[model samples]
Target: MNTGSETQMGIIPPLFCIKCGLEHRLPILIMTAITEQAIQDCMTQIRQKQEPHHSLEIQKYAQLRLMDFAPLLGEWGIDDPKNTPKAKPLPNVAQAFQAAELSAEQKSKLLNYLQQAAKQGSTTAMLYLAYAYAVGKFIAQNPTKAVECARIALKHQDYRAARLLGEMLAFAPALASDVLQNDVQIAAQNWVKTHPKLAQNAEQIPQLITQYLHNPIVAKFVAKQKLQQAKTMGSPIADQRIRGLSMIGVLSSSQPARQYQSIENWLENQLAAAHMPIESDDDMMILPEHMPLMVQEDDDVPVWHKAAIVGGFLLSGAMITLLIIRFLVK
Candidate 1:
C-alpha cells in the first residue's frame, strides 16, 4: 500500500492528499516532520547516553541535524529553516548571556552571529542583537544602537523586542526625549495585555526606565508614585524595594544634605523605638560594650536594635540605660 522510500537520507517521500486523492509535492511539510523527528531522536539518544563525551557528540549531531533539511527547504524557497517567516526562532539571547560567564569568546561569536542574522532581516536575530547591545555583551556598550535594533525588530511584530525596546525607551538615555518612548510604552502594555504572564515583568519596566533614563526630578516622582502604588496594591515587595533603593541612591547622590537628614531621622525614630537615647547628634545611637552578652538578652526589641545593642556592647562602655528601658518595655 505504501511504496515511499524508507532510506536514512533524512528525506520523507511525498504523500497522497486525502482531499484530491492525488500525490502533492509538499516537501516543506515532509521536511519539517522529518527534521523534528530526527531532532527528537537525537535528543533522546543524548539523554540515554551515560558518557559525557558521547553526550557532547550527540549535542553536536543535533545542532547539525537541521542542515539535512536545507536542500529540501531550498526547493520550497525557504532559505532559513530556523528563522523562516513561518518558523520564528526562540529567544536565545538570555541563554547566550548565561553562557557568557563560561566562555567570553563563544559569547562574542554568538553575538556576532546574531548581528549578522539581524542585518539579514531576521526579527528574532534583531531582538537578540538589541538585547546584546543593551547589556553590552561582547561588544561596546551602545544603548542607542540597541534601541534602534529593537525598533526594527518591533516593526516585525517581535513582542519580546517590543517589550525590551519599550523598557529602554522609557528609561535609557538614548531615547529619553524621543517620541519612540510613548510608542514603546504602548507596545509593551499591549504585549502584557495579550500575554498576561508578562504582566509580572511589566511592572519592573517603569523602574528600569527611571533608573536608566529619567532625570533626577522625574525619577523621584516616578519612584514615589510607584512606591505609593506598591504600598496600596500590596504589589511585590521585592520590586518595590529595588525601585526604592535605586531612587534613594539617586537622591542621596544628588541631594546629600537632604538625604542625610532623611537617613538621620529614620535612624532616630528607630533608636527611639528601641528606647535607645540619641548618643550623637549626627550618628544617632552609641554602640554598647559586650555585644554578645547584650544580644543574648531575650527581649522584644527589633532585631536591628538588638544587633545594634550587641554591637554597642562590643564597641565601648556606652550607657546601657536605653537598652535596659527597651527591655523593660518588652
Candidate 2:
C-alpha cells in the first residue's frame, strides 16, 4: 500500500498508478522533490519527445531518482554519480567480501577502503584484513603481520579474530618452525589451559606435530619431547607408541581389508587360547546356537561305556530292520 513514506515532501500522495502502481514511490518522491523549474523543464522535455525517446526518458527519470537520493545512497557506500557514498555499507565487512568478485582492481580498491576502515578501529575491517593476509588473498602471505592484525582485532573482543589467531597458531606451517623455536608449544598449552574453550582445539596440535615428525629434517625436533615423555613413563609410553605405530601401519598399508582381517583373526585366536570367550574380534563374534549338552549315566553303567552300547544297538538294529524290510518287499 502507498503510505506516508512514499509521499513527496510537500505534495499530497497520489493514488497508485495503473501502469507501474506502487513501484513508482521513490520515483514519485524524486519527481516531487525536484525544484518546480526542473519539473517544468522535465515536462517540456517529455512533451517534446517522440516515440523513440521513451526509453531515454525513463532512463532520465531513473537518473533523477538516483541524484535525489545521492546522499542517502552514498552513505551506504554506493558510488553512483547521482548518490553519495556511505562511510560504510550495510552489514559492513560481510558486504565487502561479497563484492570481492567485482574485479581484481575493484578488490584492491576495496582493500584500501577496508584498510582505512581498519585504521579507524573497525574490528570487522581488521578481522577481514587479517583473513586476507592469513590466506594471502589479494595480499602476500604474511602470517606474522596477520597475527599482529588479529591480535589488535581480538583486543576489541572479536571472537572471530581470537578463533582465527588460535587456528593459525595451531596449524599454519609457515609459522610452525619459528613458533617451535620459541617454545610455542608450551605457550599454546598454557593458553589452552587458561582458556578452557581453546583447549578443545588441542586436537589440531597433534596433527601439526605429526606433519612435522614426518619431515626428515624436522623429525628430531618433533620427537624430542615425545621421547622424553616415553623415557619418563615406560610402560604407558610403550603402549601409546605401540598403538600409534599400529594405527600408522594400518593407515599406510595398501591392503586395508586384508590387514584388518589379519588383526581380527589374531585377536580371536589369542582370546580363544586364553580360554576367554571371543565376544568380538573387531567386527563379528561367536555366539552359541543352543545350551551346551550335559552327559549323565548311572554309576553301574559308566558314562562312556553306556554311550558306546547305545550307539552299537542303534546301528545294529537299523541294519537288521533294513534287511527284514528288503526281504518282505521281495
Candidate 3:
C-alpha cells in the first residue's frame, strides 16, 4: 500500500445545509456533533448577510438579460417583481417572432417553447400565443386559436383578454366558429354594459364601438345600443352617428323615401337646435385701440356687454345710411 503513490484517504460526503438547501463539501470534518437547529441558525445568519449581494445579482441579471422585454411589459403595465429570475414576463411569443434579429430556426424554437409554456397554464404565454396565432406571426394564421386563447385568458380574469374577444366578435365575427358565435354575442353584450370611469377606459370605449359598428352579425344592435349609451352619456356627436347608421337600409331603398326624408329633416332640426360652443375665457380676445389684444380672464363675458357693442355698431351703421340718403335727396 505504501509502494509509490501517497496513501488514499476516504472522501467525505457533501453536507446538505437544510436551511438554505445548499450542499457544502468540506475538506475536513470536526468531530463535534452540532445540532440540526445550530446548523440551520448558522445558515440563516449567513444567508441574511448574503441577501443584499444576492438581490444585487438578481437585479443585474434582470436588467442585463431582460432589457428586450422591458419596454414591452411597461407598455402593458404588467407588474413584474424582481423577486423571481423572470422579468416583465408577459405574452411575448408574437413579439419574439416579429423581431427582426431572430432567424427562422430561432423563431421555431421560441414558438415551441412558448406553446409548451402556454399549455402549462401560463396566462401571459397564452395571451401572447393567442395574438401570434391571430396575426400569423410565425405560425399559420388561425383566428380560432386566437379566440380560444383569448377566452382562456378571460376565464382566468384577464380583463384585457375580454377586450380582445369583444373586438374579434365585433369586427371579424365571420372568423368565429359557429359553436362560439353565441358565446361571442353574450360576451359582447356583457362588454357593452361596462361603464368606463378612467381615462384609459374612456379611450377604449370608442375603439370598442367602432368594432361593434363593423360587426355584420350584430351591427344594427350594436349601433342601437351605442345610441342609447351615448344619449345617457350626453354625447351629441355619438347620437348623430347612431341615427345615421340606423337609416342606411331606408336611405338605400326607394320604397322608404318618406322615412328617409323624415329622418333627414329631424337630423337637420336637431343640429340646428344644438347650441354652438361658447368661447372660453382663453379664446375670447379683446383689443383696445392703443393696446395689444387682451384675452378675457373670466370664463364668461357679460351678455349685456355683447349686446351694447352690437347696438353701438348698428346705430353707427343706421346714422351713416341716413346721412347718405339725405345727401342724395338734397
Candidate 4:
C-alpha cells in the first residue's frame, strides 16, 4: 500500500538496490515510478478542487517528482532534475503570497514561517529562502546571503540548491532557465579529473568557479554559450531575451541538454510580470512579446550530432549542385 508519504519519496528496497547489480531494471522502474507519482499528485490536486492554490501545489509535486534520478536523470524527456530535492506543503503565510501584493508585515511573517520551517528540517524552506533572498522576494536582494542559504542546503544534500548556487557563480546571471543547477558542479568534476592538485578538496570548487565569474570577456562567451544552448533546445522565448544578453560567446561551444531547476520560482515570476498591475518593480520582466512559445530544443540530439548537421547540409547541397550541372550538360 502506497501511503501519501510513501508516494512522496520512498527509499528503494535493498532487493532493487543498484549495489546488488539490478542495473537494467533500476532506471526503468525509477522512471516509471516518477511518472506515476507526478500523475497521482496532479489527480489528487484536481479531485480536491483546490482552486486557490492549485498551481502552487502542482508545481511542488512537479519539482518533487524529479529527485535523485541518477540512472534516469539524463534520459528523461524533461530537463534533467539533477538532484532537485522534494518540497513540503506550503504553509498558509506562503500561500497568501499568491496575491498581487502583500503588506510588509505579511511578508515578514512569511519569512519567519519559512525560517522556522527550515530550522525544523525542511530543505525546501531553505531553497525558498535562497530564492527569496536572491530575487528579493520579501527580503532585499543579497547574493551572499542567498549563497549561504543554498550552501547549507547543499551541505545537507538537498541537491535542488545546486542550480541557484551555480547561477551565483555563473560567468554572469541570466533568466532562470538559461543556466543549469549542475553546470558548475559538473564542470568542477571535469576539472578535478584533469587537475587533481588544484582541487584536492571539493570545497575548492567555489574559488575556481569564482575565478570565472570575474572575467568580463569570458562572461560574454559564457553567456553566448548558454544562449546557444537555449536556442538549440528550441526556446523561442529565449530568443527575445537575447536582445539585452551577452552575444560575445558566438564562438563558444554549446552546452549539454538540461532541465530547469526552481520551476515554482520561475512560474511565480512569470505570473507577476504578466498580471501585476503596478509597473515599477525589481524582478526581471518578460514583456508581452516575450510570452511563452512552443519549444523543441531537440532534447534528444547530442552536441556532436548537432555539429555534424552543418556538414551534412553542406554535403547535400554540393551533391544537388553537381546533379544540376550534369543535367545542364546532358
Native RMSD of candidate 2 (Å): 31.3
Candidate order, TM-score descending:
3, 4, 1, 2
Best by lDDT: 4
Worst 10 residues of 4 by lDDT: 23-32
What is the C-alpha lDDT profile of model 2 across 1-330, one tens digit per residue? 001222234211222222342222221222333233443454355456522222221322322222222222222333223211222233644565544355678777878977888888765577667656554456653444565786676566543443344334322322433223223334433433454442333334334333432232232223333333333432123234334533553112122322122212222232234333445568886643222234776559778998999999999999999999999999
1 versus 2: better TM-score goes to: 1
Q: Write the per-residue lDDT of candidate 1 for residues 1-330, one digit (tens) a residue.
A: 011222212222222233432222222222212233443565466457532232221232342322222221122222343222722554455455445263667866787787777777777677656555554456543444665776676566443443343334323222342313443344434443444432333334344332323333443333333334334433224244435445655222233222122222222333233343335557565543211123466558789998998898876644566677789999
TM-score of 2: 0.28
Better of 2 and 4 by TM-score: 4
lDDT per residue (tens digit) for residues 156-184 in model 3: 65444543444344333333232143443
lDDT of 3 at 64: 21
TM-score of 1: 0.29
Output the better candidate (2/3) by lDDT.
3
Q: How does model 4 fare in lDDT?
A: 0.43
**Runs of candidate 1 exceeding 4 Å displacement:** 1-87, 90-94, 102-105, 171-175, 178-330
Give the winner by lDDT: 1 or 3: 3
Global CA lDDT computed for model 1: 0.41
Q: After superposition, which runs of candidate 4 have C-alpha atoms over 4 Å from their true positions?
A: 1-86, 91-94, 167-171, 174-212, 216-330
Candidates in order: C-alpha RMSD to true structure: 25.5, 31.3, 29.8, 24.2
Candidate 4 residue pairs in backbone clash = 79-259, 80-259, 163-181, 221-249, 233-297, 234-297
TM-score of predicted model 3? 0.32
TM-score of 4: 0.32
